[model samples]
Target: MNPLVLPLVLPGVYAPQEDTALLAGALSEEPLPPGADVLDVGTGSGALAIEAARRGTRVTAVDVSWRAVCTARMNAWMAGVPVRIRRGNLFAPVRDRSFDLILTNPPYVPAPTGSRPPRGPARAWDAGGDGRFVLDRICREAPTLLRPGGVLLMVHSALSDPGRTIEHLRGSGLKASVTRRHRIDFGPVLRGRREWLRERGLLSDADEKEELVVVRAELPV
Candidate 1:
């Protein structure tokens, strides 16, 4: 992988990672309409949102963390892009708005089940034990935020059950599929939870890699 050429990424905001790059690459392949409305859920540091704006789309980015919101705003300004950055969880800020494209790289690291995700830096990852804390919510709520024929491009670790995401999107009447997949060694968070993951039977002691998948879902026009 080449070095990630990114705008200034401030502390406390989620920096772009492998999943972010995969989703961004997938976003580049999308055939967007002129001045399409785009939503970047959980837009930490506004990476995906800025990329969408660079593609000439009108972008809105939202995050629950004040630090993240500030960081994203700074990044957008530095990139000379007009991304509407808001502070909210998931789709709350844009409840009534619909988008032509929705891009996300939500938290998906498996943590202990039933334990609340930690605040601070861990908030960027640290999903519940199954790693679906954020992914499930995104799959459930994101489709409703899509305009007709709109698309959602979400990247998450396959350890979180990518199949379940496809099923949920399909159940919601969107055509969903895995558009991209890549195997990468575990990052810090996952590496720290390596033993726990094995205990949960989600990983094996010999496994050092995890698969990241970009799930694309399109609503019927």
Candidate 2:
């Protein structure tokens, strides 16, 4: 129940990076209304949902992790706000539903093979080869989940073209662009990500370097 619990040790405990948490908190400064309806996709730690709720918004958050789902709802309760947390990949839980604001920090790690992945399937952090697996799927699905004139806020690693993300949203019939950025040591789990790509001859860079991007996409009516 404590915020300091071991996220790595706990099942479905997605310990977000410091920058991720910071980015979530910063959403209040954006143009979102004080009481807009919000959806937090891939609600790791439910930080974004909690933050938006704290800002007086009604939030419905989702994650593939059962523990995360429960944790998110509980975290919202503990924070003295109401949030509907559900278990589903991408937009399954909220099909046919729309939100005024959508936020996601998806699992961008590239799991080239089924045999690989730190936590395996259902953890919601494993994206298939190229890491674009989840990113691409989410982009394609976001428009339908967003309400008319709604905004889709996303945070993903620069390891996979941030520009491509913007392009995807733009091409998907939405207005999109980069809103923020920062870098992090992708941790030991992704240590072999580039190597896996290299083994397949997809990556040629000898040095490891990447950035994470925060993008804002909107479904303008």
List model 2 lDDT by residue over 1-221, tens digit each: 02333223245467656445546744766677777889998886787787788888888898877777777777777778888888887799899788899888887766766545446333555666666777888889988888889998887776667778888899989999887776565566567576786676545666464566788888879
Cα miss at 49, model 1 (Å)?
A: 0.5
Highest-lDDT candidate: 1
TM-score of 1: 0.96
Tell how far residue 134 is off in model 2, in angstroms. Answer: 1.3
RMSD of 2: 3.7
Please provide, for model 1 over 1-221, each residue's C-alpha lDDT reduced to its tens digit, 9 standing for 90 to 100: 43245667777777888888888889889998769999998988888899899988899999999988998898889889999999998899999999999999888888875568677878888788788898888888998899999999999988999999999999999999998999998888788878888989999878999999999999999
Q: Which stretches of candidate 2 lie over 4 Å from their true place?
A: 1-9, 114-122, 198-206
Instruction: Indicate the residue-level lDDT of 104 in model 2.
Output: 87
What number of backbone clashes does candidate 1 have, counting pairs of residues 3 or more apart or in separate chains? Answer: 0
